[model samples]
Target: MSADKTILIAGTYDTKDDELSYLADCIRGQGGGVLTMDVSVLGDPKAPTDVSKHDVAQVGGSSIEAAIDSGDENVAMQIMAKGAAAMAAQLHSEGKIDGAIVLGGTMGTDLALDLCSALPLGVPKFVVSTVSFSAMLPPERLAADIQMILWAGGLYGLNSVCKSSLSQAAGAVLGAARAVEPPKRDRPLIGMTSFGKTILHYMVKLKPALEQRGYEVAVFHATGMGGRAFESLAEQGAFACVMDFATQEVGNHMMGSGISAGADRMTNAGLKGIPQMVAPACYDLVDLIGWQPLPDRLQGREAHAHNRLLTSVLLSTEERREVARLMADKLSTATGPTTFLLPNQGGNEWDRPGAPLHDAEGLAAFCSEMRAACPANVTLEDLDCHINDDAFSEQVLAIFDQWVAEGIVPEGVS
Candidate 1:
């Protein structure tokens, strides 16, 4: 009745020895194997660990003496974090561990992030942190599938309340490890980006078409976190081709909005030499957190309160031009084949003729800038229709088909 999977338990053993041990015991009780990693800098644990602090320091390319002599807590912990991350990643790669669970407060959570991120996207990584889901954790630092549980009342000493959280976290990681089905690569994978149907409907038609053509399609939402995941996969060279149409996260990052994928968004696919079909879908908007005060530069713009949590601001004509230039600049650096798809009338549903966010003049400005700023290496196709129209999808299919015929894109699964 026991699970055969092994879970790596990581924490500062000198400080949280009892708590970390409890997590290990819970996993073992469920028939799961345990491997413990101690990332402490100053003190020794009551019991020796599977991976000791000195071992972590050495893996991080420094010695325990060097870390202690740094005379700074942050510096010492960073050394430990680097070592712990590498060790965990190495263990998983060698098939010695199936999943990992890390326990900590702020300092422990910081180290936990690096350790979890070191593992690829789908090897279960869980964190028990005092600052779970807090603003202190930036969106860019999060791994796409990382899980977190709040350490609640058990910060100092383990109690019944804290035990509830720990016991659940232990069981959850073990369960996830046993249940996860790694992605199958039976067909060539195509990565596409877009909003939901209300804003962008191309994916509704595109996904099935791609699948019918013997390819696998993944549609990523163009919100902050979603874009981050898309970019991370692109960097890994995981896609056969990328249909990157929903690109608002680029402008969001350029405008210093909190809802940003990252500064490196849009450039990864190109850097990896992955073929990309780029478009400026939703390029006329900047997303901001509704709960926070609006930035001064965006205070007076046309705004749509999507929900209590999010607000979308319509960019000025001049702002739209700036974003177009930024897109062009990013495409200019592509070492791979790149194509720019320009829909002359509008980019999204809200920017159609009579919609609240529509502005013909703004759309025209964006189009002109895109035409003028597009790089010489990129093939630009100007479509005389809105992005949401049937004609737009047809044009996309035409380009995709041509690429497949020319051997630029991979052949569909036979």
Candidate 2:
């Protein structure tokens, strides 16, 4: 509702000129500023946009002439998407736009994803699409905090139903821009990862300890989306250090499961030269949707159904060993100091003795493979305890303290 907040309304202005203009009017009616970016490649809007198609193509290192010459809709749109994304990022960097609302069907949605991803985590991004929440959009393709609304009955022309979706999306993006509070860098921040307390309780102890030392702690759940967000921030060099304990996503990806954080999950912090203390919590389990048929390889394997929406399957010893090798290979490329914490007893609650998903041989195979494959650059701490044990948390703090003392990790503010 604030007049000072500006929202970037982006779409194919040539085809959906009426729709995009209505969205802009809705924002203006609420006393919010608007910036329009036209991603239409073939035709022009009746009037000019805040950013034109020629400008977008030029920014993407091509020209409108070149795009038209290509004669392929997909290729031309891709060119526009790249330019539009770069322009959005530029606008935000230059303090011109506070948030963005992109409108489209399938093609527009594809471009919208890239545009929103170009912005940082906290800036509001709303996508009003016909394919809202459709399976065609993969988890890895979404911006972590992207908001979407179904453009019900609003595909071709403006009607009451479509207008409702647009009006709400316009207000939502503006309101979010006005109300959002992005994390401040007042203190050094630590990015840690874990599951819930039932399986990994180390965060309950580690978070407060890290904060007491004058650092902020952010513990990310290692679910598919959560890991995507964690990796996105890490790619931006957002953390002073990282405690990456729950790496189930890596195993999920290696096992070809649908419940995966993208292939580059465990590599971001290292690529950015952020000091990381890593562990394999939940490394023995590959989570699958509870309602779906189990994968053939996991047909008779031990499993624990977390709920109607989620299930976890224990990996065989050979699979565990293979995953260990995968983890080591990913960690081997870190440019900064790295430590690997290997717990001998168990990785998670379900892997403890007599637990439903417990597998001693698999755990042993994982540990043995990790001990052998861990690169020379990574310090391997083979601890005689479960990942959930008090000693594991203590070892983490001790190593962090040592890093601070050795100047590998900077001291936190008082």
Candidate 3:
């Protein structure tokens, strides 16, 4: 941190006053500046804050006098959270801070969540929470790319445990802000989705092909959390075009699997009107469990474990067709040029001939339903090759080239 980047320190200062002050001094010791925002509900902070509780509460449509006089703890915290987010966001926009760190037990964690999400991507958002990376905190609740560390033994005071977590978190934020260089936006970026390389190898072919055409490429794996990040960034208009080749998260969500990426899995890029081509990659099997023992509830359909955390279970023809209809329904609302690529031979690795999960009838049922349900405003292409086939990659590149030539995609320099 030779440039001395400013790090925003936000928390319930009344409860964690000594902790927050120690953190500020630690960061300042590392040659980084600090901006403090107090989000305490009832009491006053021992440390001075750039944004005071009175100002923050007023900004969040509440008065400190009212909050202190009469209110529920949760309601007061909510008001403070809103105010902290507003003040933090304004500071960030004015370039007063390069990154932010928020510390909390539970209420503080909830308050920090809002402040973290309020800041945009590329700002180092970190949370030192007692519930760091807990299953209770869903990926959607945190901003994309937020880093979290467990606040071990940090419930009450400044012990060795608190010092260790705070010290590491302070260093982590500075390291992130200093090391990250802005992206080279010389070319239009194309986002491509994939799963295991064995299943969605077209990612490899698509990347170089798009780069050859003077476009940049970003690939997102189709895991549950990965899907959320991809969708969130797309909503921010990060990509000029998207090759949505691996869409299993949608089916996973429909099946109520833990591998779900929420209900809007396959709709973000379409809603943003970015030129996009979608394929049925990895839609063959719903992810169940990995190397772990299969729960009795997940019995049937030729389950196979891919790795420690990925188990695939086959979907019947009717189930596959139903997902296809749902997907087409979502695509029908696209506001920009969209293409649904139907790879007639197969969709996922398990759908090929002689594979344990292969179901020709299921694939055919999906194709029929998809083609019939596709909107007339959207384009549909039926290809004879499998999703991972070389021909599929070729077709995607060709479509991208045509989109660029027609000015549907802005021409990007290498």
Scored against the true structure, residue 408 in model 3 reaches a CA lDDT of 93
Q: What is the lDDT of residue 359 in candidate 1?
A: 89
- Quote the positional error of residue 29 for candidate 1 in Å: 2.0
What digit string (tens of lDDT, one per residue) describes model 3 on residues 1-414?
554798999887888899999898888898989888888767888756898888899888888777766757887788888888888888999999999999998888888888888888889989999998776776566676778999999999999978999999999998888776766677888888898777768887888877887888888888888887788778888899988888988898888777766788888889999999999887767886575566565576587778788888888778888888888888987898999999999987777899887888888888898888888767999999998899998998889889989999988775
* lDDT at residue 210 of model 3 (Cα atoms): 76
lDDT of 1 by residue, 43-161 (tens): 98989999999999999999889989999999999999999999999999999999999999999999999998888877999999999988678766777788999998868878999
C-alpha-based local distance difference test score of model 3: 0.84
Task: Give me the displacement of residue 29 in model 2, in angstroms.
Answer: 1.3
Q: CA lDDT of each candidate?
A: 0.91, 0.92, 0.84
Off by over 4 Å in 1: 1-3
Task: Show the colliding residue pairs in model 3.
Answer: none
Ten consecutive residues with minimal summed lDDT in candidate 1? 135-144
